[model samples]
Target: MTDHTPHTNHDSNRPAPDQPRASRRGVMKAIGAGAAAATLGIAGISPAAATPDVSLPTDEFVETDGTEFVIDGEPVYFNGANNFWITDDDANAATEERVDAVFDLFDELGINLVRIWAHGEAKEGELVLQPEPGVYNEAALEHHDYVIEAARERGMKLIVALVDNWDHEGGMLQYAEWADAESRYEFYTMDETREMYRNHVETILTRENSYSGLEWRDDPTIAMWELANEPRLEQDDVPNDMDDLEPPEHQEILGEWIQEMSAYIKDLDDNHLVSTGSEGHYYGHWEDDYPDDDWDGQDYLEHHSYDTIDAASFHLYPDHWGDNPADPDDRLSLHDGADYITERVEDAHNELGIPAYLGEFNVNLYDHDLETRNEFLEEWYDAADAVDCNAVIPWQVVLEDTQDHDGFQLYASDSGSIIEDYAEVVAEKSGDWDGDNGNGDEETIAVGEYNTTDTTSDGLHNDFTGDGETTHDDVTAFFENLEDDGVQDNPEAFDFAENDELGFTDVVELLRQV
Candidate 1:
């Protein structure tokens, strides 16, 4: 796994001039009280008096219209960033004050969306959300709730990834360890390990917001639930080269897991969309029709085959993919990467019929300076625009104070200057697409006009009374199914437990959404 931790600076102990001066505990207290009133304040205002008289739009939720994201029944476009640290379980790793400052920067820059990690594992001395299998930390969950509410207050949407593929903050491998499995791949195939994961998913989806009085499934601030962050299986002795590795059996196992989890999340709450969170790597085996590489395998296309998956996502790292600085001669140029992204975006739209997201991308700032990075991002933005891709969230956005490296951090002085310009371009392009000329004045269609794609199963399997909608009747039927068979007749429709069957957890999932 790549070491994403920021490089330590000798002067890191000193706060930057622009860093927030508030104490972490004070900020957390404010966040818990209410995000709209407490977390939006600038320096010098008392937390009690920091409440802004802003009214956030409560009804706007994002859905898909063909290959585009429709918000409030109108096509929505965005430029976003990944701030995985916002939901940091370690209170010291990410302070509440810094979180506020980061969102403040996002608001200033017109970043409409963010991707945050919703799962963290307790291992390697790191603070984690789930300290053990089937165990959770309430304070950690509250911190995440603060992030969701805080984002909503800022008019920004979030894509919350359920877990990490890498070892950082404990991931699939940790679950396998808990199950005493020999390999991380066991997390997918082993019944005990898979159950641990299912339990975690259920815990997350059914969790009620400590602050909002709403369950996570009912929260519209969340745009989607990502299955994992760049999920890939381990290969033996291959030196962890992501682009040049093979794991045929592991691929199949992951595919099954994805289908199971995607269906499980949908059964819990059909409102929000789900993404596979694959890195969009192409494997020759996928095309060669290799034995056991069936349609249910973990190919870029097959990962989206499940009815519950609403979008395709991929990450781009031209520098890493090409081993740029190590072998500059063989590195993929900015234009080359753009061409690759354009093709993938086109394929996603043409073949899958679902929107595609450039979920993560970044040029190595260590190798390229701010100007070159800016050029790279501009070319990528242009390429995405040419194909009408749904969104582009760079590898990361961080506060100027916490930056450990020049390449990944967008808060550096030079990069911040470049991003200010890039933000304007994105805002203008998005505004034109929405027919608002960069102003927030576009009219939205009625909620009933929102287009919903066909689900995997036919005809209100969970709708119980066949009333053309999911309501209280379905809730009653859910309980009945749980009591009678411990599984829905059509497992694909109401099997939220992801245990190949259902029981009490499925009931919890149904009632929370209802």
Candidate 2:
């Protein structure tokens, strides 16, 4: 009965099951002896019982760079939790009651997005089996259903990661053999393995739940399919024992294969969106061509940043890669973490020309180094908002007692500040659209009759117009319309005009506001 899992900030508010039944005496007092006959009917009605929830529509989903999920022309945000509960740990069981409690907490938090891991490796005993057709694992599949159903009940959205290369003891590279013909890990570059991954994805997309009796392929519950969790350039551990390396050739080949599979997944289940799991620390791997590679079929760019993410991700953290380099200025004392992250984010907008997300971030609550973690996150939130960055998904919510402690989960002693901090920030950042005057300063961009769902040029939200690829002028036109209609909304609507060149950063600011 000893708790093995790393304690998260599970408190009185920790997600728990719905109201427990009254005592047996009280139940008997109310129902009397007639309850026996009613129990017979409970079975038939239980599965068919109607619940207050909405299912996502089946159709190609469009998530904009500004973090909008447009399904059949409507916009939504995926505000959910990061559930890595399905791993083969002692605590790795997903019960319906536990799932229900998590869902209830999400609902309470007004969260609509959920991040679930779809680890692709098989396991031998408790150890992970590289490329072992993990899809065949019954427990894994069962947990998947439990998670999906829970999200459905809350009318939440999902960001599904196809592979979890970052978490297990060995990391994704350890499973490279499963990917390699010579190794135990199944590599996607291999046609057979790729096909299997594709088939498995197809199964998830097409499979209907015996519980909800609904298929997720067409539902909004699916936000996007992330290609891998922190996919890297190397198929094996790095040369210097460092986490990253520039495996251009390997990444190029792997990127192409991933793109093909991405396209394949999209083709088979056009209803939902598809993307890669957060790219982890390998920022150099992504390029302008990255999106065109097919893996970028969707609008969102999911990336991870800690203290190192000064450029692309607006979120900052306590430290960067490697042993913390001593800041000569002791910059840690200035709370300039937000500025650092924003500076990098701005550069990315100017360089890459796409909106980015600080997809995952959090401080280990149990870390004896709690103060550093807390201070780091405080500035991160400010930086995320200061630069108008996309979204932030903290590390995790709850931990199961069945799991061993690893310093990741947030226990009741730790999570209070972060949970409340994030909640407040999300609320305050909620506002009207604004325009970006590309030179760097943000301005008020009016909301015009831009139909994000339409393929017309000149519309604020149109990426493809009949005239050609959508242009900034088209976005400007939308703003003009909005201004004319007195609907000029958030300042995130307008693009910055640099010698008359309009770009997506401006549009994303506007779109995010929308």
1-514, model 1: which lDDT tens digit per residue?
2455634431223243232333323433223222312243423222231111111234466799888887666566767888876777556666667677778777655577899988878643234689888889887888888888788766678898987878777887787778876555666778997788788888988899988988988898889999888776644412233243355665666778898989988888888999988777654444443211332234777777678899998877766656443344554555576776887788789998999998988777777777788877777777877788788888787765665444576663545544445455554444232232222223221112221111112211333433222333444454543434323344554555455655555543433333
lDDT of each: 0.64, 0.45
- Per-prediction TM-score to the true structure, in the order listed: 0.70, 0.58
Candidate 1 Cα misplacement greater than 4 A, ranges = 6-57, 124-127, 234-248, 285-298, 325-333, 421-514
lDDT of 2 by residue, 114-204 (tens): 6766553544423232335534555556566667766755446677776554545333444454554432123544566666667667766
